[model samples]
Structures are given as C-alpha cells and as structure tokens.
Target: MDYIGWAWLFVIVVCIVIEATTMGLTTIWFGIGAIVAWITSGLGFRLEVQIFVFLVVSILCLVLTRPIAVKKLKIGKIRTNADSIIGECVKVITTINNINNEGTVKARGQIWSARSFNDEVIEKDEIVCVKEITGVRLIVERKK
Candidate 1:
C-alpha cells in the first residue's frame, strides 16, 4: 500500500482507540472518515483527494451525528436521600438563634446542625421546615 493508505490505516486505529476509551462521541466520526479514505486510496485516488475526503467526511459525520447521539445518550441527575429532605418539617433539638449561630434539629431519626433561614430565633422543640442545605448545615424556617 502507498503512504496515503498507511496513514489512513494509522489514523483509523488511533481514532477507534480514542473513541473506545472515551465513549464520548469524540473520535468515532474520524474513524469512519479514515475508513472512507483508506477505501478511496485503495481505489487509486490521489493523496490530496484522499486527505480532503477524510477531513470533509469526518467533519460532516461529527456535525450531523454528535448532537443526536448526545441527546440520545444524555443522563439525568441521580437523586439521593439528602435530596428528599427539602421542605420536610423537623423538630428543633437546640434553640435556633442565627444571631448566636446556634441550632440543631432531628429529622428522619438523624440530628442535623441547622440555622434559621431568616435569622429569627426558633426555640427548642419548635417545628421547622427545611428550606435548603449549605454544606452540613440545614437552613430552616419556623413552621407556621
């Protein structure tokens, strides 16, 4: 085979390896283009023509298929137990006085350090609804 054919084979192998390792739609199109270029070279196409076809085919495949492939393979965020706690009510185990920056609560049988959402004082034993979580601290507001 000519140098163009060897180059095409090399490019095809490299692109396939990259696509296999990443599985991220990064280089599979290049592999397809390399295959086309290899076939064109074998059919007696000029080196320049082979290279041009390779580039055009690679770009076309990538542009036409990438978005569709990505959309089909898209993954959604995985929810966790902590994500279920938003808006849940819990009883204060310690006074919630954001002015003093002290608070604790019991929810789902677990104690969580907490703070009042609006900095208002929440007495011990008061019920509060979880608003959000910041690091390990739960931001809460008194349940009306």
Candidate 2:
C-alpha cells in the first residue's frame, strides 16, 4: 500500500525468482524475512526497526532452516554413476599397457572398465585395488 511495501515485495519477488533458478533455499528464507519486514512496516513500524528485523530474521532462518532443507533436498549420497564405486575394491582381470588404455578389473565380483594409474601393465588376475573411479572408468593399481 506504500513505497516500503512495494520495496519489500520487490525483494521478495526477486529472491523467490533467484531461489527458483538456483534450486536452493538460500534466497527463499531471505524473501520470507523480507515479507516479515513488510508486515512490520504495515503495522506502522519505523524503517529502521523493519530493516533490523529483516536482517536478524533472515540470518536466523538461513542458518536454522537451510540445513534441514538441504538434507531433505538431497537424493542420497551417490547421485552420479561414478559415485557408486567409491568404496568398492577391484582386482585386475586384464593386462594394462604403460602407454595405452584397454584394461579390465573385477570389482565387487563384477568386471569394470579399468586403467592404470601409473601406465604400468598389470598382469591378468593380479591383485589390484580400486583407488578411485572417474566417469565409469576405474583407476586401479597393484595392491602390493
């Protein structure tokens, strides 16, 4: 109904739009806090008090609500296909070249695409450990 109301509504709208695009609760809480400021202003509060309330409430909401929101928004730990092999150990099932690619490893009782981390050919059936996985490819090295 006035300039302060319009300003608060603008902030809320902008924050909501940003949160929509970013898909994070970061701005949404601030927007809600701004709405609270608008309410305070509508209740005949001074601009200073409204701004202070907005800042305090926004910080509090962001600190308190964000963690819960983030925990709920996640889809478990491993979202990508590569993340599935984080803790899996693999054994060398094929020979690896020192200069080329083309290797295989047995991980979790399943054969997966493998490569040498140091370009060393690991013999067939050699004991190798899956150190890290990168985009469906396993970077393996000899165990001993």
- At residue 110, give the lDDT of candidate 2: 73
Candidate 1 residue-wise lDDT, 17-134, digit = tens: 9988877888899999999999999999998999899999999999999888878887233446886788999999999888888889998999999999999999999999999988
Q: Per-residue lDDT for 49-108 in model 2, tens only?
A: 999999999999989988888888872344655566665556677786656677888766
Displacement of residue 33 (Cα, Å) in model 2 is 0.8
Q: Which 10-residue window of candidate 2 scores lowest in summed lDDT?
A: 75-84
RMSD (CA, angstroms), candidate 2: 4.5
Itemize residue pairs with steric clashes in candidate 2: none
* TM-score of each model, in listed order: 0.62, 0.67
- What TM-score does prediction 2 earn? 0.67
The local lDDT score (0 to 100) that residue 50 gets in candidate 2 is: 93
lDDT per model, in order?
0.90, 0.82
